[model samples]
Target chain A: MRTFSRNNLSFIILMLLPALLLVTIFVYYPSIATLISSFTNENLRIPSSGKFVWFLNYTQLLMKPEFWQVTGRSLLIVACTLPLEILIGFLIALLLNENFPGRGIVRALVILPWILPPVVNGFLWNWLLNGEFGALNGLMYQFGLIDKYVFWLQHPSAQIFWTVIVQTWTRFAFPMIILLAGLQSIPQELHEAAAIDGANRIQQLFKVTIPLLTPSLAVAIMVEFISAFQIFDIVWTLTAGGNVGQVINPYTKTLMVFNYQMVFRDMKIGMGSALSYLIMMMSMIVGVFILRNLYNRGVDK
Target chain B: MKTIMKKSVRYLLLYTGAFVALIWALAPIYWIIVSSISTRTELLSKPYKHWIPTHPTLQNFIDVFTTGQKYRAGGTLPTSELLISGLRNSMVISVSVAVLVTIVALLAGYVFARMKFQLKDPVFFYIMLLMPLPIWVSLVSLYFMMTRLGLTDSNLGLILILGTMALPLAVLLMATFIRDLPYEIEEAAFIDGASRWQTLWLVIFPLVLPGASSAFLVSFLNTWNAYMIPMIFSNTEKSQTITVVLSLFIGQYEVAWEQMAAATVFVMIPPILLALFFQRYLVRGLSMGAVKG
Candidate 1:
């Protein structure tokens, strides 16, 4: 048995070898190197192995108004879009949960927006919302809502508003799926019991359904919060990162977009690395808080 | 009469909600498809002439697929050659990442599920920690490493990065699948003098085929849909994926809506088909960890 156990150990090590190497090289090493590089004066254009300059990058970034604007914009996107996504997702989930004709097909179709590559969603919306020849403008005009075409993406505030709508469209399906699963798991008897106790549908929904659905909602919120906070790809494609020569769009520069410009465009590797850590730290803090809430809620139940 | 009215209203509300959901889910896609099949004249006409094109044409799609043809929108647009090459590159990278990641994930997943190693718990926890760290956090360091290794603008570089990105989830999914399998099969194989490696291939492999395919499909869709990594890592035509190529259509002077829409449709077809056909696996693979947690 001892010899067999020894042989099994070697097999285990062999099996685990590839995953360990890949994760270390790709995930762990880069993460650690990012932390170290954050302290250096690394610049891609500068050709030298950058020297350590502790907190210089952090201090400089903290002082920059552009940094705050970008960070604030990212947070604002999360604030604006998270609730819309959750509410729409919850409402859709509730509607889908009830049996109807072709419910299966409708559920399948609902995943379309979520599955489409976010870049494609951006392009699709851009086409739909184009100033000169957009379908939206045409429809609104035919309906006599507006005589002149509204250039949706041109104005800054409108740009932010549309960004939120596009994001919600692309993402709400995920929370819907999660919430649908949550709903299915709640026993039918719970609703029956509520009805027997003289609770109306709305009352049962508030008293029984909402309380039971909190965990799934929490999970969905955490995932969506992180996703929205790290918004990229869509914003990039939507605004084309704001013209060629510019560093970033003043209106829609989220953190990831800002990091892209700093690291890839400006070649300011040190500043970008610092920004990366800060973004990671913020996400981690929020993530841990939500997780603790989830854990405590679980314990209580 | 009151009860009937209430029941009728409930059904009315449900169907109305379903109708709105359907339209919300599909309108953008429908518009893209309409635009793809519409002529340049129809697309650019003020107050757009028709809800569905009066004169729909497949010319845009043909122009997208045919090589070396200059797009109708004229000067300096992405030639058909670039879009086709981009599609090819995407296919290669996605397939390679899916296969390689699944194999590695399966091996790792099996050990984590069945082995009783001293470091198992710590290693698993470490991986879980890495899962939520956004890819942007490592973008800079990874760029430097890839550049140093001469891996920038290469297929292998993308496959490696994307595979690594997909690993933790793939591992977790595979582990869950394997844990559900009874261990007696493995025990029987071992008692028959088969090696652990042999038992894995000959016994466990067949049992976990469904899980493996789910992992493969999810990874494939993820790699195919990846834009940011490919956009940064792959600079040249040789390695640029469809998403990167499609992005070039925008930000151009006098944007070619028709051609861009056609390309978008082409790029969307594979993922849309996969999602529709194997949605069960997709939903399971995507939501498994969160729901389990």
Candidate 2:
């Protein structure tokens, strides 16, 4: 610290001040403002009088029919994706981590879905699920499996199903990578020691691998859950039509997407701000829940 | 016999799992490559949808770049001046935001990591807590903030929003990576009269370039795919981005499935190719959790 010259200190200070100021104004201040907005009826215009409405927004959100339904649907998708992603991700990561042939290629190939832009995921799935021209039907036809091309994104059930699969595809590679790191970090000797004591592979996995992987798995679940809950693009891409409420719950469309619709489509700035605040609060609750649950496990250890 | 049977089942399960994941991973990509090379008639062709094009061509790619004003019908992709400007605007915003965010986060990250400031622990947790909300929510409020400040419809307004959006993750990540840096190296630099900026630029920056790179890439991806923020603040021809232009595919009356797909593939390529090259870093970065810092 003593070696730093005044010029050097000032230069670094100058480099950082603009960014810090930006964060304060844009990030921090707005965050506080959102908390305030959630309680009021502030719309397209900011308050002329700093009007404060109590828990009106939160209470209104609770009564909205679209709200609970969307939460349920979001939960359904998260429920479906989380365990399978963990199990499938764990097994696949294990195989790829094995000192086997073409391991590097396998690792690289598995991560392909992660790098594509979110919009592309939307478009690619759009083509695959295209009723007439989609590749999915083509592949099924090639195998003589189906006589007709299914309009996968048209039917509500099919739409939700495809959205889950697409979202899972885009996300699973992420958890796999994390769990693999956790797996590889564990020393091989633990398994060897357990095996010498007459434990079988199943026992070793249940007793050693699973417990050791718990912290990593917890982190993976937290990431997957938070991401899954806010999922928008896949849904928006699939049925950005009159279907937001008809096909799915209003909120399942994502707090962000809902904000877009409210602000841009409906042109209700106050309601949109209200929606954004709700989203921030919901995500914060989820985030805190994850931290408590996961870190508690660590603390228990 | 029992042991052999068990080994076979384990191998079978492993192979089955791997194959299923591989299919899920490959389908959309195969669709992208095939669609990129297909003709319009071929795309709309009948039964047994060609999984692979019978006659591969780069016509779609050419059409994407060359097609004049997106011929919007009742419902279709916006093929107007907005599209071209949107493309250029995306390139500018994503790259510039990535650079500005990365550079700023570098110093803040270093300070947070090495400076031993008060409330650092609480602040770091606060950043992590703030990370989960969809960025659009941030933009909705920020748009109002910008409007109040009279900064809407300007590129700098966007740069400011996107830069701040990138910082929390950048600072958190930069701090952790900097923590792992050998304190001795900085001490050596200091003892040798290497000023703080000199040490940061010459020594620390090089050491944590990966963190910077990862942060920059995240910033780029956020700005690149961002739809809502840009849509609200820069709905004008001069300011909006590729995502908004593409969303025109969803306008109520018409849907341009083909051209929209074409537009999508165009915007999709740079980031996908970027991910392909940096997939290693991005994954490593994501897994670190600290990488988001």
- Number of the top-ranking candidate, with DockQ as the measure: 1
Q: How accurate is candidate 1 locally (lDDT)?
A: 0.84
lDDT over C-alpha atoms for residue A58 of model 1: 95
True lDDT of residue A299, candidate 1? 15
- The sequence of per-residue lDDT tens digits that candidate 2 reaches over residues A1-301 is 3653323455545655765677668877776666666666665444462357677666787788776676677778888888877776787777776664456766787877776666567667777777877787888877888888878776666667777777888888877887888888889999999999999989998999889988778778888887787777666655554222233334236544666676666655555566676666667766776655422211111
lDDT at position A10, candidate 1: 77
Question: Can you write out model 1's per-residue Cα lDDT over B48-151, one digit (the tens) per residue?
Answer: 44778999899988876774345333354457777888999999999999999899989988877777767676776565565678787777898889999999
Query: What CA root-mean-square deviation does each model show from the true structure?
Result: 3.3, 4.6
Q: Which stretches of candidate 2 lie above 4 Å from their native place?
A: A1-16, A43-51, A242-255, A289-301, B1-19, B68-83, B133-137, B250-259, B290-293
Best of the candidates, TM-score = 1
| lDDT per residue (tens digit) for residues A49-157 in model 1 | 5889999999999999999998899989999999999999999999999987788988999889888899888878887888889999999999999898989899898
Off by over 4 Å in 1: A1-7, A46-49, A242-247, A288-301, B1-10, B67-78
Candidate 1: C-alpha RMSD to true structure equals 3.3
Report the poorest 10 consecutive residues by lDDT, candidate 1 chain B: B68-77
